[model samples]
Target: MLSRKNLEILVAAQKRLYCTFPELPSFEQRWDFETDGVIQALLTRLGDNDPYFHPRYAGHMSGYVCDVAVMSYFLAMQFNPNNHSYDGGRATTKMEVECLDSMARMLDWNHYQGHLTSGGTIGNLEALWIHREMGANTVICSKGAHFTHKRAANILDLKYLEVDVTKDGSLCSIALSGLLAALEATDVPVVVCTLGTTLNGAIDPLDEIFSLKAEHDFKVHVDAAYGGYFYLIRARLAGRNRKAFDFLPAADSIVIDPHKHGLQGFGCGALLLRGVSESTSQAIYTHDSPYTYFDRRGISIGEKTLECSRPGAAAAALWATMQCLPLEEEGEFSRVLLSCHTAAVKMSELLFAVDDVRLIVREPALDIVVFYIECADISAATRQLYEQLKASGFYVAMADCDISSETGVFREVSCIRLTLMKKEHLAMVDELADQIIRLSKCIADEYRSQYQAL
Candidate 1:
């Protein structure tokens, strides 16, 4: 049984968070939309309207709470398994193994193998390390790929090749092929394909890149952290055209975040290597232990995992959430996520109507809809708009896109991105939309008046 004091701490933590919520709502709100929506409705009825966005802070997608995630977090704490060694936590490790298998199967890789990591960055580094060990000297990724890819290359001390992404933020296959040919001439190795880019949610052309791999001898790794799970949700909705869903399992290794789309709390992610074998032994550096060895499989998790002393509580939470909500078509969680995609499209449509702001990418590939303030040399004007909206309680940030000039890379573009989630929040979309339109018009008018006077 759990200790009374520990239980009290949990309760106290909840109360404190609730008390401080309005003042400091972290990207992740503990209360579900339904719970908060009811209070919001009541307040609106009473004419005590208040906007929910926190100024100066962007919300993290991993912070959101579903009922299953909350239950998983607590239940895992109860078991308190230490997934380091077999003796310490056999059952918990087995649970993680099953989860890994499910992740592989979901990606359609029957012979795939993977383990949980703290998050996508760790998973990415681990995958890159394995590929580096397998004779990859040069790593190629989209210019818009997460900074972690370059950081991972730095960690390994390898030469990183960044392919200029197309205007939509996806790597062009021809450009990549030319680079690969140039690298091959120089005897370079390895290509890391991006499944979904972080900034604009663009999916790299996997089929074309894989075709290049078939002709050449370079290992491929896919960073599917943000968009991999979309396959399952999109497949169920789109049915026959599931060809796009099949790209995940094709890479030599892949990174998928259970925290991002799995609806679990943060710090729980997985890195999967296709066809893992004894050659890929995870290093062991520990004092002799009775329960360390496993006879069936030569590789224990510690061999492959980057972390040695991680929280099994995260694994237990994920396991419990999986039990409560399966990833099938009929599951409620997938449906909710599908609804989030719908909400994104809805938001995009509304944003389109506002003048002087155009979508960076015409159509969204996932939940992220990116748009920029399309005015010239007007950082001051845009900054003013951002300040006004933030002061009015609408939280958003000026997104940056690196543009290459003769001088080098510069952050010359400014945009606002909306990551839509929760069906209940969709109901408030129009209200938010109206505010954006109103603010944009006001700012444009101010800009025009000032320009004319000057």
Candidate 2:
């Protein structure tokens, strides 16, 4: 599935970069026979990985990196610039700023400050760190938020609270309001709203959350790590989903992962701050090295970020990809995102037609579709179906959903999860739906036969 043309482009770009630095002496790098053998062995070992790049691999949040991103990353690696300071990566640092500017505009932020990070986890950590510096002692998030938020709160020594989710896996606004009102009596709270949840891709009601913010004195941080880019396609999204992105501009901080939906390779996440001041930016200040920031007069990324020595290749990859697919409404990238949503809706329709399949969410908020098998032992049947689908070359993932009983008890039920992230999935939705039905029937038949034998 890799592109040979992109590889050639990378080679050409590397040569051009080398020619630009003719004043520097060139050194010949020599490798022994053992090095070649080890490299070959490593490639063989990596071959065992599942085919995440193919259309059939709709298992997780992983999406295919575009050719331009791959080529740009490969070309950038030739120099391996560190984006910590301008002294280390003058060109890449500027590229990162421009990339952030594009993303900020995409989110409809008039004025913002942001920097790239290793991934969503660190991006969230840094945002929360800033919240702590603002004197917020407690962090609140929905139960459906990414697990990293709670872990980050613990690491930062702040009080972490999880509000219950509604039946649709959205943050329960009633519960959140009560918590915020109770907490407001004592300490300031920083609410972490998840734009898209991991399990079912459910979106928390950000509009309601913002309304709450008006009543109480609290900061709002949006963890749009998986769903931020959907802002470009908001017009095509379901009404409920579109409302979430509408309130994105009101957030104090936002975390987005370019690696997930930005058509770039891994190790690229961003944290955008709205209406940040010089004092707020100085909350993450660090002592500079004499060797670094000598030439730069303004704010360095290292001074305001939690990480140092971040890869410039990630910046190059994102910059190149954005250049080809600009983040604009009804653009090529937005159309691809809309295609993912359409494909997901198609998958949901197929599951609804099946008698034995029970949808976790009637309609997906984004590209992820989740459903469980209807059987006496639902967990076992769902697990069997997951394994059967993989064996049949239809890869998918699984999650556990809590079902509440009339007696006020909860039970965990295993469910199948499909993330229709690849653009090619738009064309394969029908085939994928057929495969799911056939595989599910086969697994159900096997289960019945085994039950009769028992």
Candidate 3:
């Protein structure tokens, strides 16, 4: 939970910051510091936004950025440092490297290489691009893979193939095995595994696929953009999901979003390479950026990364967040994450007790819980309920693609996917559950005649 204390500290910091600089005569001409008119304008604009920090906002991945990260970002934003090179952001660049080193060590990668990207998409683009640069012919990912995989393949002009997924929305290991066997023995394809599919939060079978990689001679890349941090609590996950994260060390490259589950605001993602070997040196280069590398101590992050002019403030925010919530299994961070998972489990139990709503996945694999009204027309009903829930102060996300059950209980249908990410949600579980249970019954009752005819 947040407090007014953070605001007080920020105010104090702002006062100290002003004392560091001589006030310019033109500073008075700048917008009023705390004008009622300006404050009202901000309130009017930002108040209309979805209550992302609220427990009622079970919607989307736009969860709350913790107080430390938010305060750190605002404080660093004043400096407006660019992380492209040390010439631009010396302190922040060092902070970024240290953060990357800590994350690499968390995944058990000793001699790993990494750099922060603008976000997950570019981070993923670089990972697959590295494999392509290594002369891999094809990039294969599950049908449940993020939409970015195919686009990244297209951007790189590499052959892209998609394997089917299992009933629970996970990548089908059997299908992947067959696909690998059919590929030419000499074909060392780069297989992309999604640790958390955006829609249902399904984890690909990484451990199962690792065995196939050795037998078939393929490189593995993991897109743990949303689920990467969950590796810390693998023991708390369901069997398959836990097993998949257990083999995270085997992946050649990994992309993770600090913004998603790493307790930061938008646009902070990282790419982790196993090691900068002779073969992968093509991807990581540090020759001589005459313009940006003046008096550079070591390799500039811009040299190793595809994107230039990344934000140094992002590094500052994440670094501050890590200080408060160290990436340890038994730390405060993991406890908060576990509480989120518990909210999802508790939500599932509550929905299960409800009369007519059908849960897409029998149980949530992660903090995301997907469920829908069991009506004749799910598309119509789900859209209706999505808006209705929002109006009633219970925001939830709509699925990207249609969901169905294996036994044909629920056909191709739109569903509600709630990202129970905030720890405050644990307290709201019963109220949220009651809200859905009561509304779901109403939605179901309205379509009862149509249901009986079917």
Candidate 4:
């Protein structure tokens, strides 16, 4: 199920794009060998991949690209613009600026300097690199934050520290305050706040974290790669979540991935710096390109980005998608996000009602629901249930969680994680929940039988 309308539009748009350069003499270059059998083999090989486009594939953060974005990307691929410099892709460079502006506006940023990257990992790396250039030695983040933060710190050769997270998998504000209070005299260069965690989709208390900046001299960088688009649906979010979105603009820098919730394909992540001057970026990232930057005297994207040869098609697709969807609270895009969150909430309710299941979080903060099978050996039962579900045509993911017990000790637990990213998932929530409950019981019974036999 792909959209036929998008296919037609892409073909028509590609023809128009070709017609734009009529002045150039056209020459036909044809391949000498026959390619029909090889092409069929390639298609057969690609079909072996998982069905991530289907609504039943709620396993991970992989999302289906919108039809408009797909069409726009295909149309731009006819030109294959490289966004390293204006000379490489003049029209797409302007599109990248407009796309970055739209993202900044969504975060309530008035004045900012930003550009798109290949993905969140590189975007976060650039944010930390900027902090390192500003003479900061320590990088701090929640334990639940993406693992890239620590790796990025290592790459930057800076000291790294992790704050504890609460039972809900969110960074504990009290623990963070304690850590900062102890390091009151130290220079903690960057404090990375994760807006949406990888495992449970937990959002740290950004407002409280930013409040600590009053006493500490650290720059706050928000990793909103997965949850940044949730800002557009603030009207439907819980109070705490809404408050977190409200504090987004206070960050010194932020990373948001257009490929995630922005309904675009992969290789689109953005880094936004608030009130950063051109001189500072020039000092850090500026490099002399002998042949590329000759066309423009002003700052090219190549001078500001950590990467040199980014895809201009990514920018074209994002700009076209934003033009059609628009980042507004009452827009169709916001409603789609709301539906994803609603599906998670509904799934959580269904899990709560089942005696054999236990939710990792009281409720889903975003569109991810995580729960474990209740059994004598929870880890085994959960794994068994995960495999059973997969075998039964329902693809879901698994995560290892740290659970706090009544004795003030932490235990490792394996949990089944479901990300309701597709809008069509809203209709499958009830059936999915019922399937989980039934499979969990079967797994639990099988485990009990084996224990008795032992």
Candidate 5:
């Protein structure tokens, strides 16, 4: 449900907006407008869509974006500025710069250069394209990495190689070392490390991957689209995960999605580069485009990105959200993520007591909880649990995982994936776990009855 108080505030602010500009022209935006009926129909159609803001929808690597982002995005679109050129988005471009710097500080970079992209996919594409431009031939990534790296490699026509992951779902440095050692010495491969994988919230060891750089020459690019904001709560995480985030500043390039955990709406992500200098970037951006980049008003962010004509509204939304919830350790936003981690922890503990449940990692490295039904027909039971949960209005996801760890943990089963990403979901986890057990019991009983009759 939309907040009435915020809507009133937005209306009040909108009234004040007209005072700033000369009132030369105005148009009616009431129900009488020609598109109003169509908009009403669209709203009705949207009711069938899944409600992601609700706590029940813990299906995937997404969460409830904050209200401030909605308000800021709506407010900025009134001007409809384009962030491609300097004069085209004088105000928003600076806001985007500030937003980039804020994210840089979160990553512990005192000085850096970056620009916002449409989302993580394009953000990663630009990084790979830059590597290709720098004479890098092949792309090496873990099996757990996002599919975008391989797809981007195909789009750019570069050779792609996949490495093995540890049983804990992290990129195996040993496998990567062997791959790098065997590669032709003349070729420099771009190694893509993941901070948080989409399948399971597994964090690759960033610190260990960089260690291999000296032994074998390769540029390191981090795919933190799902987990970059976890940097804010680095102290909350421990062991391999915490150590991995600490080494983010050492990465050559990083990709993050503000649309996800950053609490902005969709279509907002960023690409941060460490080694690309100002003069070098200028040489890269200065192409033969006559009329587009002629404006000397300020720095145009489009030069830093592969995408053209980016929405300034996304930048405005991010800038405003940062003001409301600054990306800092031990801050309110970090506490939200901490609550999610705690929720996952609680779910893990509760699942242990359930009759037919096996946690994939015992404890989640992040907020994603994975468990399979330990039954004779495990696959069927897992699918039934997923469908019944959705029907019960407690939407969760399913993952087909084949896991093998260094600790001698091995499982090849269809599993349930619970992404308790909302702060509110923390409170309901106990009940959520109860529902899983109750539903699992029914599934097990039904399977038993069928087997006995047969």
Candidate 6:
């Protein structure tokens, strides 16, 4: 009787869902069934409800048409291929491999090996795990690297050294050299440089750090989940027949996220490794279950991967999206990526021009701009600004206190971070600029009134 009641409830819910479909003009709907609104709505809801998902919830996120990714996510769900084994879904995993290879080539290490993980954090963890397991006792990065990098190091029980960054939020090469000299001969150090920071998308000096690989035998891993796509843009604008363009050579291993730049849905990140020999990534498993092993090796994917049973939908979506985007002349991703960088520059210009609000990063390394108002009481003003901006329906990020504190800028500076990914985001920047000006004036008036009352 309870099962029957639940069935009835389910049927009623389905009926309610059906009522939400948009009514369209008959002729257009008949001619363009692909643009059907009902199908799009269904896909959007599925993406929001799925496990291992980042819910967009009708709010602007990272200046992306997240709804589009949601559509791809659901569209790929139809096949439901298990990409664990070639025997089961060889075609799907092969497509995933091709997508991974495209990313590898972009990083300038065609020989690199990698696999898609859940997200950037997972990608970072996998890279660190591989590096640590191979033999890296100590890790080094700028104070501005993402929290996940530090968290991954802590999980591995590894000690990490953080160097100070310049005012532009780049790692100081001189500071890094000094730290290396200070380290004892017995100390083991592996430099993990950030290609793009999370809070403000500040790119560390890749060329300088990579040059150190010759002086020191330490391995270099790039956390390029936020800035890897920038290299492709730099190559494109240089034009044909240009010799020796400025770009970071692919490190020993680098983390890239499809969800961030590849325009695919979330839960898609790859860790490209320069020298991923069989010994470094050999599959070692004790569980000898004959039932699970159907492939040539007869080994389950769980043995090779950190997570068991990763969704094939994410891999499929990534493969499909990469197919849609064509590569550039020098074998890089599409020029559309450069548009995102340009939007970021425009936004930065608008933000810097605002009265009293100072740009934290004057020139952005990627599609991120960070700025703050100069005030004596930074905390109170920042809190007020954050609230006002949020209430205005503009989604921006604040710098982490711990990271800023270590960099010697936390107390003196509290800034907001913006990522420009969508072209529509450019129209909104003027409005944001106006809001900042209004917010600064409001803070000044409040402070002045308090002084007079005192």
lDDT of each: 0.68, 0.85, 0.85, 0.86, 0.86, 0.65
Error of 2 at 330 (Å): 1.5
- Compared with the true structure, the alpha-carbon lDDT of candidate 3 equals 0.85
Over 267-320, each residue of candidate 3 has an lDDT whose tens digit, in order, gives: 999999985585557434545655766745755678778888988999999999
Candidate 6 lowest-lDDT run of ten: 50-59
Task: Kindly indicate the candidate among 2 and 4 with the higher lDDT.
Answer: 4
Clashes of each: 2, 0, 0, 0, 2, 0
> Could you tell me the lDDT of residue 227 within candidate 2?
90
> TM per model?
0.79, 0.95, 0.92, 0.95, 0.94, 0.76
Q: How close is candidate 4 to the true structure, as a TM-score?
A: 0.95
Residue 99, candidate 4: C-alpha displacement in angstroms: 0.8
Q: Candidate 1, 196: how far from true, in Å?
A: 2.3
Write the residue-wise lDDT of candidate 1 on 55-160 in tens digits.
Answer: 1222235335445456546755655666765555666778788788777766666786678899999999888887777667778888878999899999998889
Model 6 reaches what TM-score against the true structure?
0.76
Question: For model 2, what is the error of residue 383's alpha carbon versus the real structure, in angstroms, after optimal superposition?
Answer: 2.4
* Cα misplacement distance, residue 389 of candidate 2 (Å): 1.7
The candidate with the higher TM-score, 1 or 2, is 2
Q: How does candidate 3 fare on TM-score?
A: 0.92
Q: Which stretches of candidate 1 lie above 4 Å from their native place?
A: 1-63, 185-188, 235-244, 282-300, 402-411
Ranking by lDDT: 4, 5, 2, 3, 1, 6
Which should have the higher lDDT, number 3 or number 5? Answer: 5
Report the Cα RMSD per candidate.
9.6, 2.1, 2.9, 2.0, 2.6, 9.7
Please, what are the lDDT tens digits per residue for candidate 5 over residues 1-454?
Answer: 3479888988988887776666566653666458878999999999997788888889976677687888888888988989998878988999999999999888778878789998999999999988888778899999989899999999998899999998778999999999999998667799999998987789999989988888888899999998888888877886788999988889999999988888877799999998877787777666756768677878888876788899999999999989988887878989988998889888989998876677777778789988877666776788999999988889898888874332244456678999988889899998888899899888878877888988
